[model samples]
Target: MFECFLEIGFEAELNTKEDPELMEIAYEQCKENVATRATAITELRKMIFARGECHPLRTDDEYLLRFLRAREFIVPRAHKLMVRYCTFREQNKHLYEGVDLWGLVKVKDAYEGTMLDRPDTGRLSVFRFGRWDPNEFPVEDLVRAGMAMTEIGLRQPKLQILAGTVIVDLEGISYRHVATLTPTVAYQIVCLMGVAIPGRIKGVHIINYSWILNTFFYLFKKFIPQEAWQYIHFHGSDLKSLHKHLDLEVLPERYGGTYRGVSSFGIWLNKIKKYRDEQFDREMKQLGYVIKE
Candidate 1:
């Protein structure tokens, strides 16, 4: 039944195929073209190999293009992102230990939703902090799960080209949830979403906001980059305000939209199982992700 929704708009966009329209978007927004793309990827590869670290790196055009697109085909910026990405993995090796979707099923608070049916936007991914049980699952595990999902999403050209948005629902957040975010973890999170990954996040909408959420933000505001912080919009239980940025039809009823369907991680897990091949495993391994049995 959930697959029906997947079939509607999400499934088709999950592939690597590049449509003419999306290609135009890429060219206009990211300056991507045959000549520029070749040059950028080559420059990025040269920079990456010059580091003499990040061994077993996948320097193929497809893999390198991700960073190039993320940085709008700017070789230097893309190279920096690749370095920071590798550095993040090296510093937080524990997060990748045995991190896979199957292992992350217990993390029930987050799920990827479909993009707006409109052709203008990419996708919207939602994370519900209020539904998270910190005691049942460690914050580290939650971060790991999030990283796994992001890696999977990045495989699609649609996501890379069109970019995406994130919704952080903070309705039921409590002090206990806030306490779990140590200063170190807060910094790591800021770096993870803000810089390390190639995800072209268009915006992040924070709805159902409460003072507890504000307290968390206040304590960690210094860690957040100014540009990224600017992208964050807080709507305190005001779905009307949230709808101004996003179409109401695309949002689920829980977010004050008319859509009555439920968003489930299980549906996403099933959909992404196709990515659990030998090649995907190798890619993860090369990126320093430990694939636990």
Candidate 2:
């Protein structure tokens, strides 16, 4: 239904979904051309196989391109991120199970750090904060849930090539919230978000933020790479700025937008349903990962 609302007005500089011209721009900016893609794949495969393992998305042309574009098509950068993404999934089998299981979503639902529904025009995504129960779920669980959301986003053809945004709504974060964010954990999260995934982060908007939580900002600044940190925006409860940057065409009215009735979880469930249980199982098997849940 939101698709009915048009006249984007080049307001969104990165319109990967409808404009081949913009997509071409992304390819150029990322140095992602036909020749470079082929070369990267060849080099990436050789490196992956040398590690005595298989990359699940190795032969997936789209998957490789997404990574290449995310890393600006630099062979070394893309390969490093590619390997890290695949290997991390392989190593952390328990974090992600089959799509049928929906264990990650279940955990997120229980813990209250839920991923918001509907992506913006740029395919930017959002997740809720403040509702999270750290004692019950912890940062690792949040990361797992985030990964599952990323996987779901990546499966959608339009989103794979486009970058994403995350809006963290902080109602009243306290010292305990800051306590959970250490440099090491922050670094892992930064890597998972910035690289090691098909969905690259275009921006991270932290809204409804409390000044008291400033103590934890340093962890992100210190751990998250400088280049990546530039994308991080602290709205400090500025809804208008957040809405403008995200473009309300895609945001639900609840978040200061016009779009209405976007089911918080149903859209994601539909995407996951399209992915199917068996396909996820097969991918897990290829990665030599077991369904922990």
Please tell me which predicted candidate would have the highest lDDT against the true structure.
1
lDDT of 1 by residue, 1-293 (tens): 85576455444534655566778788876678966678778887888788765642578888888888888898888888888888887788787755554667677645546545333445677877678878887887777777777777787776788777778887778888888888878777666565788867778888777667767787568877777877888887888899898877767777777655444555665545544567666767765566554
Pairs clashing within candidate 1: none
Give Cα distance to truth, residue 270, candidate 2, Å: 7.2
lDDT of 2 at 117: 26
TM-score of each: 0.88, 0.72
Model 1 segments more than 4 A misplaced: 1-14, 17-21, 51-56, 115-120, 259-262, 274-276, 285-293
lDDT of 2: 0.58
lDDT of 2 at 240: 81
RMSD of each: 2.8, 6.2
Residue pairs of candidate 2 with colliding backbone atoms: 208-237
Say what the RMSD of model 2 is: 6.2
| Candidate 1, number of clashes | 0
Residue range 37-126, candidate 2, lDDT tens digits: 677777765665676444654555555666667777775676777777877776666566443335445443322212222233355445
> Ten-residue segment with the worst summed lDDT in candidate 2?
6-15
